[model samples]
Target: MKLTVLGCSGGIGGARSRTTSFLVDDDILLDCGTGVGDLELDALRAVDHVFVTHAHLDHIASIPLLIDSVGESRRFPLTVYGSPETLRILRSHIFNWLIWPDFTAIPNRHRPFLRLQPVKVGECVRLGERAITALPAHHTVPALGYCLDSGAGKLVYTGDTTYCKPLIAALNQTRNLRHLIVETAFPDEQHGLALASRHLSPSLLGAMLDELEVSPQVYISHLKPGVGERIMAQIACYAGRLRPRALVHGEILEF
Candidate 1:
């Protein structure tokens, strides 16, 4: 199985794109963002399931476009999975036939193109051969991270969280987690703002790592473009046993 980094930036700026990632071939997407536009039509068409992290606009804004882009060619329904709150935000705020036409009800009311599935925290949902469980995250809104057990080992994504206890505990308990894609959105100087907005700076990210019982290939995502270099520099100071590296758009990893 392969995981692709479509975009992993805190905020947009030069050389940075919004947050979106996917586990392709299996046709499961992690998040949808502007970077999704970079995917080819064939890839967009192959998406059958999307596991959203939160209701944040950046994490979900590209969903509608993605559905619409493949609406005509898709033969199967596209399932969007998220927490109840996240699904509600997408329904009432995004696909309410105002911001965008409700593709969930588009084409036909009975057999719509998209289906929204509410996945609660700690619940494990099976997708083909993979078992994915939603974990809680500390964000401005109700959010979740995910732990994907792909038979080989587990993979965890700390979707846009700050110093969260539940997520930290989950990570510590994850067995054989080969990859850890955590978000470090700002430099150490902006620690106050990062904490206030439920984002991680290098210092906080280090603390989160200290709580983990196992070490994995820690790849940092969702950086704030220009400050990515500085954030990583500071992270190097205290990231013991955690192989922290910045993720670039289009990077692919296989497990």
Candidate 2:
């Protein structure tokens, strides 16, 4: 199994700064952020499932567009998985006729272009040989991290969160955890804003890392565009023994 980093920036700016999204192999997407817009039409149409982390605009921006772009050509409905609350938010806000045409109801209700699947924490959704398990995440809205088990090893993605005890405990229990992609959205100076927004600063991330029992190859993600370098420097200083590198777009990890 291969996982590709489509985008990892906290916010959009230039070509390099696209919000959180990841392409799992060719058919599955971890999030539907702006980075997905870069894909060709054929590539977009190939996406069969999207496992959402939250209802945040940055994380789900391209979902509606993705459905719209390829709905006519595809034979099967595009399935989007998220927490029940997150699915509710998408239905109430995004897929509503006012915001965007409800693809679930378009053409005909029985044969729709989109489908929503609600997944709970600790429950694993198996697709062929791969398994994606939703994990706990603390954020402004209903959110979740994910554990991708490729049968060979596990890759954990802490999708937009603050310091979460449950998430830490879950990670400790994961056997053969090879990679950890976590978010550090702010620099040390914006620690207060990070806390208020339920995002992690370098200090908070360091604290969380201290509690982690597994020694995975940590890759820092979702860094704000402007202060990313500074935040990474701070992370380097505070991360103790575990050296974490910054995640870049277009990077691929194979298991």
Candidate 3:
């Protein structure tokens, strides 16, 4: 299995900044953010399943556009998986026909272009030899992290979470964990705002990392646009022992 970082920034600014989204191989999208807009129509058509992390606009901004652009070209409905609460938020806000057309009921209910599936924590959705498992995440809204296991190695993505001990405990028990893509959306100076928004700062991230048992290659993502360098530098000072690297856009990780 391979995962491509389409966007890792908390917000967008220059060419390098595109919100949070990751493409898993050719068919699965971990989160359909603004980065999905960068893909060609052919690439967009290849996406079959989208596993959403939360209802935040930054993480799901591209979902409606993706379905609108390729709904007719695809042979099957584009399936989107999220926690029940997250799916409810999507139905109430996004696919309610006011914000965007209700693709889940478009054309006909029986033959709709989109499908939404609710996945609970600890449930693993398997496709062929690969498995995508929902993990716990603590965020302002109903949220979830995901574990992508391909039998060979496992990659865990903590999408938009704060300091969650339950997540850390789950990670400790995860075997063959090769990569952990976590988020630090603010610098150490913004600890108050970080806590208020349920995001992680450098110091908070350090505290979370101190409890990890598995030593997977940790990658820090979702840095707020302007202060990304400062956040990374602070991460170096606070969590340097783990040596978490900043996740670069367009980078690919294979397992």
Q: lDDT scores for all predictions?
A: 0.85, 0.94, 0.94
Residue pairs in clash, model 2: none
Cα RMSD to the true fold for all candidates: 1.4, 0.8, 0.8
* Clash totals in order: 0, 0, 0
Q: Model 3: what TM-score? A: 0.99
Angstrom error at residue 221, model 1: 0.5
Best first by lDDT, ranked: 3, 2, 1
Which one wins by TM-score: 1 or 3? 3
Tens digits of per-residue lDDT for model 3, 196-248 = 99999999999999898898999999999989999998888873457899999
Cα lDDT tens digits, model 2, 23-93, are 99999999989999989999999999999999999999999999999999999899999999999999999
